[model samples]
Target: MTDRSPRASRAGLILVPLLLLAALTACGSENDPSPVAPTAASSSSDPADDTAATEPPADAEPAVTLVDPWVAAAPQGVTEAYGVLVNRSTQARTLVSVSSDVTDVVELHETVVVEGGQMLRPVDGLEVPPQDGLALLPGEDGITLVNVERPLEDGDEVALTLTFDDGSSLDVVAPVRG
Candidate 1:
């Protein structure tokens, strides 16, 4: 019985060290910034990965940036697009025209109060001040898409081209939402 007790104590000593080593190895240090393994959807070989492609080039800085452009869902007749136009340049810029593939006519419009009712009035252009921005919002100020060829539903995507007064144009895809 005495010999058996010594053997059991030695076994326990060996097992304890092994368990401690395993626990230390499993816990990684916080300072290590190891890259995680990419999932199947975000793999490099997937052609749908547009994160790198959509980024603007480092050498070129655009004067104007359209933020969160979206189109409102409406019936077959007409809808509107809204977004924020941010101007980074020192000179003012004007939105000259807007065209969309889903609509034959696109017009800039502003809401006005007439006879205690609100109405959308057509406007020639929308201006963005120097080093400032403009928000094309709903109900009051927005771009109206006239003669829509098809009915717009929520989650539909529409392609639009916005032309500026300086002959510069920007192509954007606006998502339709209610």
Candidate 2:
């Protein structure tokens, strides 16, 4: 005699519709057809969707520009340079950093008053507004590049890359001026 348990019978009953549904889903329907919509889980895995999701943001500012870059000529073993960082952007921007390959250290420095006397101090950074400029004037008790580590001869050139607040960069060739 064949023995059939209640659980086995119930399992067989549930399995029939599941297999039928799988077969029907696997086959594409033609008549009374509706466009299939992608499930959210599979939709995001698409290559096109991944690209669109990773694309850079729009309304990003155009490239930044630097104008009239020049540095004062110095004697041998001179490591400091001074010039103007002019922002040619139509929008205001703050210079977050400056760097050069000619010097061991590059910084945005300013001269300010301190206890009992004036002092030349290094600034965290500098700001240059739209259509404006930041002056790096080296003078007595005034803002200047301190303790330069490289020799800047006349006609020598160095590239200064300025970073703006808007995640853009500009490279300017600042020549050593006489």
Candidate 3:
């Protein structure tokens, strides 16, 4: 003959309520959706927005005006030209590629510092951030080119065409500088 204990018999009584409590807790509370829709002003109320919006019309062609558009006035032995790029538009643009008559080939390149020191790295393209611009200037980091396949002589006018991400292009006359 076996005797049954009250504690064991009443175990289900305590366990059921605990299990129900857990199940209820597991059901997440309902969340009220936010009433406000996100907008540029609401999200990022930066003053730059006003400047960017007022600068140019949306449908205007991108002006790839080369800033300090000068190439090294080195002898004809020099095969590369260095300059800077500025996108004077509200919309973001990309430097897809550059072509110059001065050089047999032109490529969009970027510089990266590697290891203990700075190193030059070539990038397929560069992005001009919205409301801002990009620089192709030379630094301790490196420089980009309207690389001429051949050397450009002083007074030799080179045409550089910058292709935008939106399939638009800008022509800049890159002049050789001292």
CA RMSD of each candidate after superposition: 23.6, 28.8, 24.7
Comparing 2 and 3 on TM-score, the stronger one: 3
Name the runs in model 1 displaced over 4 angstroms: 1-59
Q: Which candidate is the best by TM-score?
A: 1
User: Number of clashing residue pairs in every model?
Assistant: 0, 5, 3
In model 3, the runs with Cα more than 4 Å from the true position are 1-64, 76-80, 140-150
Ranking by TM-score: 1, 3, 2
Write down the lDDT of every candidate, Cα atoms only. Answer: 0.74, 0.56, 0.55
Pick by lDDT: 1 or 2, better one: 1
Candidate 1 per-residue lDDT, tens place, 59-137, comes to 4435666767999998788888988776755689999899998988999987888898889989888887765666776
Would you list the clashing residue pairs of candidate 1?
none
Best by lDDT: 1
- Ranked candidates, highest lDDT first: 1, 2, 3
- Give the RMSD in angstroms, all C-alphas superposed, for model 2: 28.8
